[model samples]
Target: MELRQLRYFVAIVDHGSLSRAARVLHIAQPALTQQVQQLEEELGAQLLHRSAQGVMSTDAGKTFYEHAQAILKQVEDARSAVAQSSDKPAGTVALGIPQSVSSALALPLLTAVREAYPEITLQLTEELSGTLIEQLKSGRINLAVLFDDGQLGAFASMPLVEEEMMFITRAGSQFAPKKKSIPLSRAVELPLILPGLQHGVRPRIENIVRAEGLSIGNVIDINSVAILKSALLADLGATILPVAPLLSEIEHGQMTAYPITGASISRTVTLCSSRNIPLTNAGHAVQRLVVSVASRLCVSGYWLGAKSLAKSESA
Candidate 1:
């Protein structure tokens, strides 16, 4: 019913115990419990269930907790908007990135942010695109680099780059690299290790393979990028992926990377944010820096098989 009630309810959910929450809020246990009871009565929903260990939110409580967090974040943003000086924006900006993208952009992005916006605290999370999307919708992350498969209607997105997927194998193997590219038929003939259908890249690869009228045989499903790379290094099977994660190996001759020619399977990387959540000054700064850094990497040849998306193409 009141802002303080919302705060108390959130604190209780976060600490998972009324007594712990009361201690954190510097209020009596009975007072905190009363506020939560009042909130539940006002909302006409039983929010939490108590247990010997601590407490757990009911399904309804979980949903309400998400909304409560978003509300509190908006309030904080509003206060910062009015109170902070114009010349220096100070706050935390959380950015989510997939593992493959993080291999290329993480350190560089961190350095750039540290130099340009020293007052802004940046939190970087490396997660799959699907996880990142959920986090974005729940207001856990301010921005993310996600693979675009035409499913992001709830977010505003800017096309960062279109990356060609490479068919990688151990160096000095039978599929020795001669040309810069290989046909889809040849790529499929080899034993393949790839991500499952749940992965963002897998569906794109499947669509391209299906369009080419080819079938993948002797396939191995690997979800973790580290394990997949290890499989390739151990001469297990060839895999198709962006080259960013393989740069070190390719340069060291530990592996060979060739473009998949006939299918030309690729994924477009998009910088995305929730359409309902307006960007703060810090968010805007980070977004701009990401675009700039990505463009520089692509243009300077640091990132292979990557084409910088024109500004005109971004939504």
Candidate 2:
């Protein structure tokens, strides 16, 4: 099968509908279907199964999916290598960013990449830290900005920045009412709308709370930052969030930022890529741009400390 057929199949998997994939690829739906079917037949397998809900991979389809994606990526990489001989970046770079990183770094990163590498296309996905890491292992994203959580052994990690999380409550709420800062112990005394134990942040937050012999109340165990933020906005309870997650609300006076006192809450955000995949010229360029923009943001805004900012400029 042709490389274009592989691309069409990948697009169909991404969009879950031939018509939708056709629209995205700017090809006629019938033509897209024909390409995919031809490719499937050539491989002697059914690459996709359709249902009322959407298209999904069969067992054989799943196996072919991995190999097909790798072939397409290698083809793109070959093109990129050739393009790099001319000192220009072109083609697409798949990026997976955690929601928190997207909040802080995505806009500046995208803007700079757009300005500097006009020919580059960025295919993007935003997910939780866990999901982003999984995608990295699966070769779905060329680069990812997410939490380390001590679980990224398959990838090389460059620490990007560390964000100090804050314990925030609704204005005038009984918990953390307009305090400049409160000890982690005091912050945990109130109802908590934090992530459940399975979340990377939950254990650390809970450890600090449990130490003071006071249990977290109203334990809502929220998973989504948006849901947690909404709970805080409604004065339901407090949640620990990095500066990025609540920056807009805090800036707009809809929410508050109460830095945890005595003991600070923080996490290291990292830039990671698969160790097995060689970094393409475009990937390196984008990584540099991400560091540059993040450093400027940190230095200009006083959002991160000097020690943490060291990695912002490094590869």
Candidate 3:
């Protein structure tokens, strides 16, 4: 119920033992146990499962822990925002980047943030686009680079770039497209390795294929970028995705990216933040920096097959 209780609960969960948390907090073990008991009673749920070794969070506790962490982060951000100067905003800003986007944008954005906002701590989380959406909605992350799937009306969004999907395969593989670009119908006929329906790009690909009276017949579902790359190298199957994820491989001549010709197979990359959660000064600074970085990357051709979207297209 209290801020101290939340802090204590988090500490206990992190340390995985009441005694260890008590030692870290410099509080008595009995008092720490009492605080947890009071919180559990108030919530009407047994948050932690006790054992002789230590303790573990129950299902209810796992859910509550996520909310507790978010609330604590907001509280810290509030304090920092009020005390920070406009010229040098100082606070922790959590930014989420999807795995594919991170391949091209993560390091550049991190370097930019460090150079420009030395006082602001930037925490970057590289996750699946689906997971990033949930984290952004829950206030776990301040901003995220997400693919615009026409269902992001609930969030404040700024279109960054439109990335063209490419049919990718290993350089010497039998499935490699001979031409500069392959038609969507021909590309889908290959033994394709693709993410499942939950992935942002997969649904788009499916819809496009469906509209063209085509269907992907043979496929292998893979979600991890590293594993997917290995599969491509091993000649498991070709995949249709933005070039960013396999940029290095393509550049090094280990992989080939053939643009889908028959249809406009692309996804808009958007910078999104929860409309309900107001950003801190540091968050705002990072948000602007992200847009700037994306533009620069597009202009310099550092991000392949990406076209920068005009500011007027923001949602």
Candidate 4:
């Protein structure tokens, strides 16, 4: 019921033991246990499953934990926003980046944030676009660079870039396309390694193919960008993705990126934040920096096949 009770419950869930949480919180074990009991009584549901080894969240507790974390983060953000100075904002800002976009934008954003806001702590999480959306909704991350999948009504977004998807394969692989680009029909016929349906790119590709009455024939589902790249290098199969993730390999002649012709196979990348959640000063600063970095990269031709939608500005 109380903020302290929420904190105590969260701590217990995190440490998975009452005693450990008590030690970390510098409170008596009995007091912590009592607080958790009070919280459970007020909520009218058992929140934790106690065992000899440790404690675990029940189904109700799991749901409550997500809400509690979001509430706590919002409270912290409120405090930070009220106390932050306009000239030197100081707080922690968590930003989620999709794996494909991270290769081009992560380091640059990090450097820009560090140089401009030394006092602000920047936490970068690289995840699938689906996972990033979930994290943003749950308040685990303050901002996200996500692909616009026509399902972004819940978030306030700023257009960053429109990235072209390419069909990629190992340079010397037998399956490599001879031309600079290939039709969607021809590309899908190759043994393709792609992410599952939940990923941003896979669904877009599927939708476009379906519109043309084309179905992907041979396919392997791979979610990890690292493993996907490995599969391409080992010639397991080709993949259709943005060129950024494999830019280095393509430039080195280890991989070939062929633009997917006969289709507008592209995704618009956006800087997204939850519509219901107001950003802290640090979060706002980082959001601006992200847009700036993306614009700079696109203008400098560093982020290949990306057209900037936002104008360049100083972070």
Ranking by TM-score: 3, 4, 1, 2
- Tens-digit lDDT string for candidate 4 (1-315): 888898999999999999999999999999898999999999999999999989999999999998898788888888999999877899989899988889999999899998999999998999999988998998878999888889999999999999999999999888888787899999989999998887888888898889888999999999898889899999999999989999999999999988787888888999999998889889988988898989999999999999999987776
Candidate 3 — which residues are off by over 4 angstroms?
310-315
Error of 4 at 57 (Å): 2.5
TM-score of each predicted structure versus truth? 0.84, 0.80, 0.96, 0.93
Write candidate 2's Cα lDDT for 138-198 as tens digits: 6767888866667778788787777778877776666665558877766766777877665
lDDT of 4: 0.91
What are the per-model numbers of colliding residue pairs?
0, 0, 0, 0
The most accurate candidate by TM-score is 3
- Candidates in descending lDDT order: 4, 3, 1, 2
- For residues 1-315, could you state the per-residue lDDT of candidate 3 as single tens digits? 999999999999999999999999999999999999999999999999999999999999999999999898889878888888877888999999988889899999899889988988999998888998989998989999888889999899999999999999999889977778889989888899998788888888998899999999999999999999999999989999999999999999999988788788999999999899889889888998899888888988999999999442110
lDDT of 1 at 118: 94
Q: What is candidate 1's lDDT per residue for 1-315, written digit by digit as tens?
A: 788987998998999898899999999998888888888999999999988998899999998988887678777766766666656777878899988888888898899889988988889999877888988997878899998988988899998989989989989766645777788888888898898876778888888888889988888998788898898888888888999988889999999988777666889998999898877888888888888888878888887889999442111
